[model samples]
Target: MAEPQDRAQEREELEEIVRSIGRPDAFVLHEVIRRTGNEELRRHGGALFLSAFAAGLSIALSLIVPGVLKRYLPAADWAEVLVRMGYAVGFLVVVLGRQQLFTENTITPVLPLLHDRTLKAAWRLARLWAIVLAGNILATAAIAAVIAHSGAFPPEIQRAFAEISHQTIAFGFWATVVKAVFAGWIIALMVWILPATGAAATFVILLMTWLVALLGLAHVVAGSVEAFYLVLTGEASLHDYLWRFFLPTLLGNVFGGVALVAALNFGQVAPEVEEKKDADGTG
Candidate 1:
């Protein structure tokens, strides 16, 4: 009886300790993200491009899954809500699969650049961004061509694809840009939060992506898949894709990731980091 009571009390104390463990603070999150950025900066160009291409190809699932959902679901009002959940599929694949995404690069690489600020660091960041963005765009273009030309899906599902693209691109240039900013901001915020989320990472990713889809936010790579599909299908012109969807979204995403996430976060932790470095005689 005495031994059993002691075990119970010990178990209760262990549970209390687990419950009382606190989440990492801003300084720790900043360090985690900064270290992640530094590692990415160190990767070779070919590896970065290959990973980014895989990410672009993987991200098409976000668009494709929604099209599938739209085709079979009822035409009821709540159906759209259910369909939006599919938007999270590709994000889950790319993020958790650890593929390189261009928008993610927008935040990850920027952290190193913000911290280092050397000409060499700036050059590395530029190279990383360019390679990743190009790989993502080219891969998305290829998949869009395949979807448009291949008879993989019946005409009905193809129509569903068209509908999704149309809705994504219908927001004019500025509106799409504004929405893209929110999308970028949310994605960057996800990156920042991920270092802290342990078992709930998948839920966090799904929730962030679903919010973007449900709110009609424009994501550069995912939206590119949609916009490129329209162009390849001859539903929209190359000019429309370049002008309305591509340019504005790229601009907004870069700004949102760099200015909003990288800048603000670095700013907040800068003083503390500098003070610590100075105290350690490393500054």
Candidate 2:
């Protein structure tokens, strides 16, 4: 039998365990934002481009899996569910691999830019964005070209790709833009939440990206692969890809990532940051 003192200690320990399950403090999350922003600003153009290119290639798996699944599975609602779940794979790889995904840029570097608000910082942000977006598109286009003519993918899988691309384009220009905004917003939020999640970081990535897919939200990089697949297969024109999907989605993602997530989050933490600055100066 435990003594009363031992029972009280056990109760206290249980309370601490429960408390430990809560979210990270604002300061810790702010540090994560600052560190990630600084790191993105610091990466060289060549390295950033290579990582973005790899991310673009990896994101193709999201499209490819849906095709493969549609080829193998019986037609049903569950098939759609499984297909949507597949969308999470590429994001998991990119986020975990620490690749320079463009949508991710909408938030990460922006934080530091917000913190500094310098002309040089803005230029650096723009330069990084241009390099990463160009690399991602170039890589995805190359992959789409190879996939279109490689004779590696089966006829059924190719058919599935066409069907998927058609559905993607069917959403129309403005709709794609709106959906892409949500996609960007969610992805940026994932970056913000990850440091606080600790060991469950991967699960958060999977869930957030899965929500992006399941909701039919367009993601600029992954959607570029879809658009390029259509172009390479001769189903879509370059003009269509550029005007209909790419430009709108890109702008929407930038708006969502920068405005919806980073700016709002900065507003919430600005006071805390100012307080710390004053404290440091006084100390």
Candidate 3:
């Protein structure tokens, strides 16, 4: 009993020491981005594009994963639950790799921009959007073509891919865009929450993303999987994809992630920082 109390006291002292080191200031996030914006933009711009493209390619597995599981366990109703775990694999790869993903940028970098609000900031955001979207599409097209030609994935999986392709066509333009907006918001929230979660960030990100996928939220990169499937099958033209899915989803994602989450996050923290500076000045 005495040993247990001593151990508890020691643990409390260690925790207090850790706390005395202090949590990161909210402004630190903004400052890091502000200080490193140029180098970060240059390095991450290409990286984001490549990562977004990779994400597009990887996300296609989501559609096929369930089908593959079903093919093996056709009679098992609970198998659907197991396949959902596969959806997190791509997100884990992209995020942990520290690659630039458009969905994440919608919130992360924008917080600093919103706090500062400069012309250069606007230009950076524009450049990032253009590069990421173009890269993602190119990646999706390349991957889809490879999958269609490779004969690697089973035929049933290919057929299921085709089925998902047809469903995107049915959603028309506006609805797909609208759904993508919601997905962007959720993804941005995941990014916002990640910095605070520390070691558990992976699990938090996976849970949030899985929830987004399970809820039928549309993501620009993820949706590219289905869009490319149609393109590969020669059932849908790239023109339709550009006009219907790509443009609308792109705009919607930017609006949802940047305008909503990033802006709001900055709004919440900026005033407090300003007040503290004012107090310091007065003192």
Task: Please provide, for model 2 over 58-87, each residue's C-alpha lDDT reduced to its tens digit, 9 standing for 90 to 100.
Answer: 988888888888888889998889888888
lDDT of 3 by residue, 193-281 (tens): 56546678789978988876666667777667677778778888988788878788888888888777777666767777567557778
> What's model 3's TM-score?
0.78
Give me the runs in candidate 1 sitting further than 4 Å from their true place: 1-22
Per-model TM against the reference: 0.91, 0.89, 0.78
* Model 1 lowest lDDT segment of ten: 13-22
lDDT of 2 at 2: 61
Least well predicted 10-residue stretch by lDDT in candidate 2: 10-19
lDDT scores for all predictions?
0.87, 0.84, 0.68
How would you encode candidate 1's per-residue C-alpha lDDT over 1-283 as one tens digit per residue?
8966765675565445434435977877777677677668777899999999999999999889999999999997799988989999999999999899988887877877777678998999999999999999999999998888988988999999999998767878899889889999999999888867878899999999999999989888999999999999999998898888999899898888888998998899999888877898867
Better of 1 and 3 by lDDT: 1
* Candidate 2 residue spans exceeding 4 A from truth: 1-22, 279-283
Residue 43, candidate 1: C-alpha displacement in angstroms: 0.4
What's the true lDDT of residue 105 in model 1?
A: 85
Task: Indicate whether candidate 1 or candidate 3 has the larger TM-score.
Answer: 1
